[model samples]
Target: MAIVLFALPLAVVVQRLYHDETVTGLERDATRIAAVVPDDLIQRPRPLKRPAGLPSRLTVGVYRVDGRRVTGQGPGRSALAVRGRDGRVHDGAEHGRLAVAAPVPSDEGVAAIVRVSAPYDPTGDRIQRALLAMAGLALAAVACASLLARYLARRLARPLERLTAAAQRLGAGNFSVRAPRSGVREADEAGIALEATARRLGTILERERAFSADVSHQLRTPLTGLLLGLESALERPGADLSAAIGTALDRGHRLQVIIDELLDLARDTEPARRHLDVPAELEEITLRWHGPLAAQGRRLVLDIQHPLPAVSTSPAALSQIMDVLLGNALQHGRGEVTVQAADVGGGIAIDVGDQGPGIAEDAPDIFARRSAHPSAPRGTGRDAGQAGTRTAAAAGHGIGLALARSLAEAEGGRLILRSSGPTVFTLFLPDTSMAS
Candidate 1:
């Protein structure tokens, strides 16, 4: 478009220059001829006439000084110039004729002015041809531009169209829908961004679904137990009634704990940050559980390296994690349960090691909702077998290890089983620096 805008006027000006040059050359020729012609010729009985056998398209004429027509041939049109000097001039009416005049030099004085005119029809014909060629070229240019514009628009639109369709599919619950990659850098980048968003959304939905399912399964056992115990106590009357009521109360408490844990899980899934003192938090939880450890006749060892660094974490989450670990140790550990924290190269490292029968080789697989270990003793709860424990020697419900792992993850740390021996189970928690 820019090229056409600038080139059109330039082409017109060039054509006009070419036509003017042709007219000027013809006028110069006529002037020269008049200058060299004999002065007697002008005073003769008849004025000098145009040459014979001239092309019919060529019109010639002569005019007196006062604009009177003189003798000539070929249409004998009125002169284009009156008393003008020997120079090139254009006819206003004819447009294609060049007019010239020269003084007839004589010994006595200046005789009549010799004016001549010649047709400039060739200039018009050349301009017409040029205009026709220009029109043809312009048509070709328009055709090519249309084809190119359509091709480019289609090429650009195809990928975006696919992306729009994929987005619609995703909106309709097809989480797997993704855009096709094509086009230039910007288009490709947009496609990649859409793909990444889809993947993240799919992952989030899947995790939520799994968490909902796990929570439902975990709650069902306690709920069933509570219902049965309450029914039994209501139907019977004796010392057994009190025991049944107590059991019902215990089941209700366990149900409450499970609900709280689920709530914690949901909250931890959201993005947040907090600052904490690792040693102080650990000391507080351990002190809370010290009585339980003493009653179990197990020694509690806090081999914390001094000047432990402050960490960023959720205080409630960190406390819950430590409680779960200490509870597991006190319930199962036969001798000593050691809690240790120290500065590792990248971050702080905390370990909870228990002198209990170590975890089985299939511990990881067993630590899922609804999974059970038939060889190990079952707790009163239905899904207790699947809880993360070295063995089924715990004194209470079997959710300590699962809760510990959840709480650790909530605080931007992980509870990993470092090693399992015949009488030892060790868990390592990396500090918040490793969260991201």
Candidate 2:
């Protein structure tokens, strides 16, 4: 549109200038012919001699005052000839041609007229050709502009398209998706920002998934205790309903505490750290598991080797760690469960050991998030059975130990497997003598 707007006026001005120039040239030729005309030509009235060097398209005529053409070429009786005798130059269209007339001066102030005219067809054709050239140039400019615009649009649009796709994938829970780069600076920056956002969102969502697994694993034990109490009450004849209800309520309260602690963990907030009575905490945990262990024809033994120093950690966190270990032992171990607390290296160490076939020595990283120890060789005594247990723990058992280890570490401690045989998992709390 802009090209057309600019070219239209330019073409019009060019055409008008060319047309004026042509008429001016005709006027000039007429003046020159009139200057050479004899002042007595009006009286002589014979055919005038033709001039040299005039354009072939022009017709020159010398006419009497009465409008009779007595010249080389033109109409026999010309209206322009009669008008030209007024002793002035005149120009107008006559008989489909541009005609100009100039007067010859005599003592009587006006004499014969010299007229020059050119056919309109040639100048009209040239004007049309000029307009066609202008139109062609404008169309060429428009085509080039369109192609360049398309190239620019695609250059910017393709990356935006990929970024949009990446965003959609992110929305659809595909956080690992990445956006491709575009060379444009602004577009590249947007891509970089989007990728960074995806990574952060990926990490956030992963933490959420991990939190969910942790919650389910952590809550399973208390839920089991609650269900066991309710089932035992149902199975017993003439059971004391109030006492059973009281026990179930207690279990529910403990479950709620565990949930609060898990929420604190999920939010990445630090639960208040205080001096903990390791012996007392273990005693409570043992009591909670005693019924379930007894129902399986097993016993849970808690042994405090000596007077233990208070450890600094979140009490609920410690309870959760112990629950995971006890749960692991109950599900996989054979003989009685032994939980022993002792003072070791100024920090407290609590070992939960069982006699079931121990974890395989060749087990892959057990603390890794949801890592399945898939390749341990099968055999007896630290072979197929323990490997299967480890695989079960990794695969269907969810991330109980992994979450336990994380909770221990969050309280400035660590949990590890001290022995593959007899499967003793130890929880070590850093010494709290100074904090106390």
- CA lDDT for candidate 2: 0.77
Candidate with best TM-score: 1
RMSD of each: 6.5, 10.0
lDDT of 1 by residue, 1-436 (tens): 7547955886798688876776565566555555655566544536555555434454444444445545554233344444442333433434445555555455765443444555556667777787778778888888999999999899899988888888888888788876777856777888788888888788767656655644553454346546655565575556476776666666566567657756666543664666577787778767655544565566778888976555676665665556556645654555778888887644667777777886667555323334323333333331231122112123333344555565566555667667666323333445555555
- In model 2, state the lDDT of residue 280: 77
Positional deviation of 42 in candidate 2, in angstroms?
Answer: 2.5
Would you estimate the TM-scores of all the predictions? 0.69, 0.57
Best candidate according to lDDT: 2
lDDT of 2 by residue, 327-348 (tens): 7787778889999999887789
